[model samples]
Target: MAPKDPLLGTLKVCVLNLQSDGEMVTDTNPHLASCCELLELVLRKGLQQPVISLVHRDYWQCFEQLTHQDPCGRLSALSLAVEQTRVCRKLLSAQGRGRYLLRLALSRKALPQFITHLLHTPRVLEWYSPTTSILRNEEFVEPFMSLLLVLSHMEFKLNMENCSFLDESWLLPVCETYEVVPCREVGMALRYLSGRVFVLNLKPGSQAYVDKFICPW
Candidate 1:
């Protein structure tokens, strides 16, 4: 993060603030909203003018379009990552959709992977100008990505069920905090890879069953 670049400078400050707030960030966390807004700014910066009036410069919209193109299976991979959000029937406006998707990505610690896929898409890459968008500039892009990688290691515990008002407001939802525990301890663990689903059973010492899990009840 360069001290000279305004976005980077602000972002560096926000991340520093996050460190003081601990590793687990919730929607109520002030720094969490700031960071998400900054990320939105990064994606929407110097965007190419759109011919469609309804089409605004939103990170999720761009990512969704990129998904349609499926560059290097990057879009496909992340499509699965966010499929839950995509099927969210509550989100009405693109703004809500974008915010929800962004938050979900952060919670899942998949923001870096999502951005990595977007960068690989040359066609969608042109939507952002190298001069204005950090994701486009060859020099800044690397550092920008590195910053996202840093975020990936942190824990985000956002409330996915609080998306009812997303279509109308930009407010961050109340993030729920839960005790630290392994996914397998919850009785079910889902892992998707290359379009394949792997299910983990909860019983201690139980082996992960591949797409063949059945309720023992």
Candidate 2:
């Protein structure tokens, strides 16, 4: 048979290193190592090829399995990986495939649980800031922010009761910031979320005016 591809081999090693318990091997570089392998796979085989597609699918499957086994640990691993600019830029800039993969990984059935976890977990939401100054300085907040964006695009209904963590007082300020400067993906996400908030008639207290402020166009 043909000699094994180094990048593929590396990817296999990384996947195997992810223990069934939802933790990754501390010694392994999940982001750099996985990103390098992904980049190589995309460059050499292209995303449509059977081999590359299988690898991509398998990588996500591993994450999903781990997530099901241990939500907190899986989110921790994902947060760590996405904090790397190289990994974030690659995943966020790949013709939107990164976003697609993320959406797929957090299927509708799992989204409510994930969002609930995000809100309840202090460490996970620590980076979420209502202040523009704080948000601007925070570099590791993208993964958390990206999840909200993906959730905005989901088709299924969200349980309003589970959304108690979404304090309107704080969310309003964050939404206002997005409206003024428009942070691309974030702006879109805010817009979508705002629309949903209005449609759902979720009480936003003083932030109810957000419905009028948001441009429907």
- In terms of TM-score, the best-performing candidate is 1
Kindly provide the TM-score of model 1 when superposed on the true structure, using C-alpha atoms.
Answer: 0.71
- The residue-level lDDT of candidate 2 at 185 comes to 25
In angstroms, how far off is 8's CA in candidate 1? 1.4
Clashes of each: 0, 0
How do the residues 27-78 of candidate 1 rate in per-residue lDDT, one tens digit apiece? Answer: 6777877887888888878778777786566667777776778746646557
Task: Give the local distance difference test score of model 1.
Answer: 0.72
lDDT of 2 by residue, 18-125 (tens): 323253222132432243234334222311223344343322322233334444464654443323312333232333333333333233334334444444544433
TM-score of predicted model 2? 0.22
lDDT of each: 0.72, 0.34
Which ten contiguous residues of candidate 2 have the minimum total lDDT? 164-173
Alpha-carbon deviation at 15 in model 2, angstroms: 0.2
What candidate 1 gets wrong by more than 4 Å, as runs, is 1-3, 52-54, 71-77, 173-217
After the best TM-score superposition of candidate 2, give how far the Cα of residue 40 lies from its true spot, in angstroms.
7.9
